[model samples]
Target: MNLVDQGAFRWHTLWLERANRSNYRKDGQILNKQAFVSLLTPPGRGAVATVVVGGQDCVACVAERFDAACGRRLDELVIDRIFFGRWRSREGPGEELVVCRRSDWVEIHGHGGRAAPASIIQDLVEDGCREMAWPDLLWQTSADPFAAEACIALTQARTQRTAAILMDQVRGALREQWEKVIRALESGDIPTASASMEELTQQSCIGLHLIQPYRVVLCGPPNVGKSTLINALLGYQRSIVYDQPGTTRDVLTTHTALEGWPIELSDTAGLRDQASGVEAEGVERSRQQREKADLVLLIYDASQSSPEVILTEGSGQQHLTIYNKMDQRSSGLDGEGIFTNALTGDGVGDLVKAIVETLVPLPPRAGQAVPFTHRQVKALKASQVQLFSDQPQTAAAILRAAARVGPVVSS
Candidate 1:
């Protein structure tokens, strides 16, 4: 039999068993089987968008709006099968899309844009499926907290490496590690559990940044190549470039991925004491950006005298000093700094590598257990504390609690 038949047979058997024990009708009708619809893909212009409709009677609801290209009705489509078709709306013809039927769900792959997905969702809603946000839908469908988090993070992943790591968690990498720790605790292996918790806790620092981009701010005295360098790094002219000082009077930000890690680069106004009004405001904002940035690039013109005071001021923060216009004669200054010519894109590649290394000292390996949320970190820390207190049972309890799934509701 086909996959659909197999799924139907299994579902029918389970339904019958439940019916025998409860209020399900003998006519094969399920009670209180509410259908829900959610947009599985990000809402924006893209190559494709996925809309998921699930629960009992969802197939019948989708069947009313879907017309298969092969002349097959939606209910006639087999589970685990893909059908190319046109999704119709109440007004007229809608966008052409691909629909996949599953045991308890239907996935609609449609053209990605504001109107197409919205139209499809409206059609589904009109057909009696309740609309739900993706995160809430994910939380409801996932088997565990780790799986739910993995599903949510997968959507925001900016690189294949990050996506692969989340996929590992979804496939039980972190869950397996949690089980190991629990088993170790049950067996009175405090040291083993403690060691595992410590390692995973340390890795959490990097894990938490997987879905969020690192903020890198460029700050320096006026007339330095900060704007030019930013343009070169982004491979586009996002910041206004001019030879005059104070050309960039406000913070200009752009996002990009460096070495498969997401990063947001900010070009700030040059820092100087002699400023007033708008220029002073920009300088103040620049300082604020430097204070909060994950990494600050303190730039100086290689041909000019170094500002030792600026470097000293930025020393307290995580920063890198870069000497621009290396094509010109080097200033007789002595200190550690990267030399580059933003005009020619010289040394930019080395600069990118340095940024990546500084931010992510040790990239996560595939299948590694890393905590991505504050709750997970707190749980790990609690387990560690219990592990050292001669409380194996308590530690085991904490470990299980850490792995427990919590309700995630959308705001």
Candidate 2:
């Protein structure tokens, strides 16, 4: 099914319309004053979780269940001020929470974990505040598609660098460029508009992979320390290590963050000829994985014969050759490959660096116009196509359409 038909994407559009209509109260407060609560952080075991409560009764709803250490009532608390307190639920003395007031909105910071956020949300729900997902809230708050996309991407950002880049988009990196393109097209400056579109298209290649991790595959013959090297890279024992050949009969994958970029490291069965039964199937699977992998680490034992044949087999794919068992006696057979001792963790860091570099040769600059989502990419492509056509007005319309966050709402 198309992305627009998906539940999340549909909600993105529906909630935006709802939020735009309910954004203001009778008192002219530019906030969603219908008592609603949404999680600002992912659901998991973490140091803290943030819940955002907004609407006319947001402060009152929270105050009913919250007791500040300073003994101040919710109405007595100053706006834009933070107060430390305990939340009281029917269950008993509630968890420790930090409350902050922002006009009609209130923020609750509490302990992280499934139980804590769940309990806190339940309390808010009982207080007449409806629970909403983070993504839906983000869509409602964003001004346009670029901003909405940036907000969604920021939530999934794994590293500081990625977050900074996405933050730039939220601050109008892509929106500014799109606006510029629109202005240029309006003024009959097709060259400028085309140039801006081309640049954004190029940046999209790396931008799309920012939130989504690049897939890297580890492949080599059995007993060559493929599993060992994988374990070293992951900083844990994720793959099984056996002295016997063909110990791993299937693909084993683990997700990890390297240098702030998300990556999926896959360990595949050793590749070799004339394997019987299951071992042969493993070897075939390894080859398949190499073909699909973003980057393949061709590992080999330095103490063994030349791996030229293995290298030649996987030559078409982007790969880095690694000579494992560097601690043992050298085979003196080397053309081009990083040497490493999986047992001692020697040269493992360099391997990771190489993989990251191979995947993303040059990182996108801060605040650069990048199209991360498929919808944005498709819109960009459509604009580019329209740019070459005889109809400049059509191109301008397409660019304007791409900048829209959701369907138009009539008053």
Candidate 3:
């Protein structure tokens, strides 16, 4: 695939999408809500537009506007089956459509133009159905906001392993754990709550990455085989590899999985004492990115004397020193570092293992509670602060709100 074609996500590497559902604060509640209509697709040009309506009267409302091509009324249609139809608008001519009927909601699929979907939504609103934004629609449809977020995260998940970890959250691991925290608080067990909070905060390193791959930036002086190493790890030619110094003028990124863990790897412009123009800018950007990266691989030429480890303060980034081009060593060397030949793919597999193990030391297991969003991690930390401050009640309230289980009575 061309790098320029995937311009936006290519360099960014499918970064995190913040799924903060703090305001809703609901879980395991009855799904009954006022009948609402929403256009799931954007009101712009597309192939097919989807409008979902849910409530006791949702099917009746949709049936009024639909003329099924199979001569079957929605009442006779099988649930989850997409029936062909025509959406006859009271104001204008009808449009071709295919709609699926579900247990609680009925989806109307029609022309993805501005006029057709807008007309249909307006008609539904006129018929006493509430008009809702797509996000609001999802919030209302889901029973638990935390699990709902997990579902959303699962949609963007890159690998089956990550998806499995996230699926646990969707299956009530997140909500159940928060429920435990709230229970401990209600029962005045501050110690237990604090310990759980600390553990979950640590899990944020893995939980927050359920959808986004970890940011792994490879950096070193000019012509140290950073590009070749990244290519070896990715098993493909993602970065342009050249033997000349400063060949990579910008940070080139690609996403790949190692040991079922998704990682976004970057090959950056070589750091050098003498640089000019775009090379200088690239070097500056690489330095800035290293500070923000979860893991930074400091690549060095294995044939030369081992370079001094660069010490960066307060960046909180884990640094792994990599001795590259082991196949071309002038002499044998001894050191505590990952040795590899990016050109021949030697020791690259061990390097990949180390990268994953460093980033995620303890992988989430089945039935484990992993707070998989910023909102969750923040709430956990905030509540821990409250507990530490001797305000058990406040901590309980915060956990309850974050869990979306509403307020619990403190015992």
Tens digits of per-residue lDDT for model 1 on 227-296? 9999989998999999998999999999998988889999999988997889999999998888888899
Q: Which candidate number has the best TM-score?
A: 3
TM-score of every candidate relative to the true structure: 0.77, 0.73, 0.80
Evaluate all candidate structures by whole-model CA lDDT and list the values in order.
0.77, 0.78, 0.75
Give per-candidate clash totals. 0, 2, 0
Instruction: Tell me the spans in candidate 3 whose CA falls farther than 4 Å from its real position.
Output: 1-35, 39-50, 68-85, 90-104, 109-134, 306-314, 405-411
What is the lDDT, from 0 to 100, of the residue 319 in candidate 2?
81
Model 3 C-alpha lDDT per residue in residues 36-112, reported as the tens digit of each score: 77666544566677777766577888888888989888878999789988887776548888988876678787877
Candidate 1 ranges beyond 4 A from true positions = 1-33, 41-51, 59-101, 106-128, 306-308, 311-316, 329-331, 385-395, 407-411
RMSD of each: 7.5, 7.3, 6.9
* C-alpha RMSD between model 2 and the true structure: 7.3
